[model samples]
Target: MSERLPPNTKIRGTGFNISDFWSWGFSDVLTNSLRGVFAEFLVGSTLDVLQQPRIEWDAYDLMYKDKKIEVKSAAYIQSWHEGQYSKISFGIEAKRAYNYATRSYTPEPVRNADLYVFCLLYEKDANLIDVLNTEQWHFYIVKTNVLNTLFPQQKRISLSTLEKITQPVSFTEIKETIDQAIYQ
Candidate 1:
């Protein structure tokens, strides 16, 4: 375990299962990754075009311009079931990275935004486990309209609808979705 550490890694695995511990850390990694990915897309594809400042709230995994364009990451999951497969919970599993530039802490600023869109990567070919890998990074964007068709159910809900989950996107249908969003 010591050998695996760089030099100042705060984590110590004197007796803990390093592999198992690492698995939990994956959630943190994914959250941050999604934050960065969402921020980049919001700023690059949308804000940059509109000429906005790129500011990221590292602690909250938030980003935007004039502190109005808010961006977030989430996953989607079934909410009307039970058990792990039945009951649905949101955090880091079944959701999408979202951008909320249309709203603000104030009422007027929230309503006056010009172009407001909440984007998701909506991968077609990538897998869930693959995204969890610290090495593999899929920081891309796809339109909400396209994201809907990929999933079997709803399409294009308000950004607030996305789950606040933080787990890696499941590989199941991920690659398939990415392919669809990117190509046809």
Candidate 2:
């Protein structure tokens, strides 16, 4: 039961050349490929847009209203390398979320124009399938950088409360997911 993306699946690349790590100093073809997959589908066809490393914006991806979006693409892997035993990840060297409730994480300088975000492009279907079933697929959304300032921590936060803090196009609630991503 294995299948590949359609020849005309139309996955567009943003031509973004992100480094694997400041330490690695090498561009990762795999990560960029996945990013291309996500960018093509982030808007779900309502608007046709593609994101890449060279979008000519001050950020990563562009939005429906022509807003410049800074994208942080990540792929987490639990494994050990050459001589180290660790569960590492192939990711954009940027943290893509904000928690106004905590203000704990460090991110790029896009607070006002560069909305904090996380774009996860995965090929595995079991983890997240049926919602948007395309290998050339990815999810995009803005995070709540002001949650701590705007929320009551002791209480469970809900999506409706953070509804305003999301991508203008996809409108995906992103902060909580980024939190979960850090731990899970």
Best by lDDT: 2
Tell me the whole-model lDDT of each prediction, alpha carbons only.
0.34, 0.37
Candidate 2 global CA lDDT score: 0.37
lDDT of 2 at 52: 28
Candidate 2's C-alpha runs over 4 A off are 1-29, 32-46, 50-57, 77-117, 122-140, 143-184
> TM-score for model 2?
0.33
For model 2, residues 49-160, the per-residue Cα lDDT tens digits are: 4332333222344454434344454433111113332222222233344544565543643233333344443333333422234343344444334433454232333233
Considering summed lDDT, which 10 consecutive residues are worst modelled in model 2?
77-86
The number of residue pairs in model 1 that clash at the backbone is 30
TM-score of each: 0.26, 0.33
User: Which lDDT tens digits does candidate 1 get at residues 1-184?
Assistant: 0133322344464655556555565444335455345434534443233333333432222223333222333333122212232221112212332345643333321122211223333323323423333233222233333333343254233333433311223323333433444454
lDDT score of model 1? 0.34
Q: Give the top-scoring candidate (TM-score).
A: 2
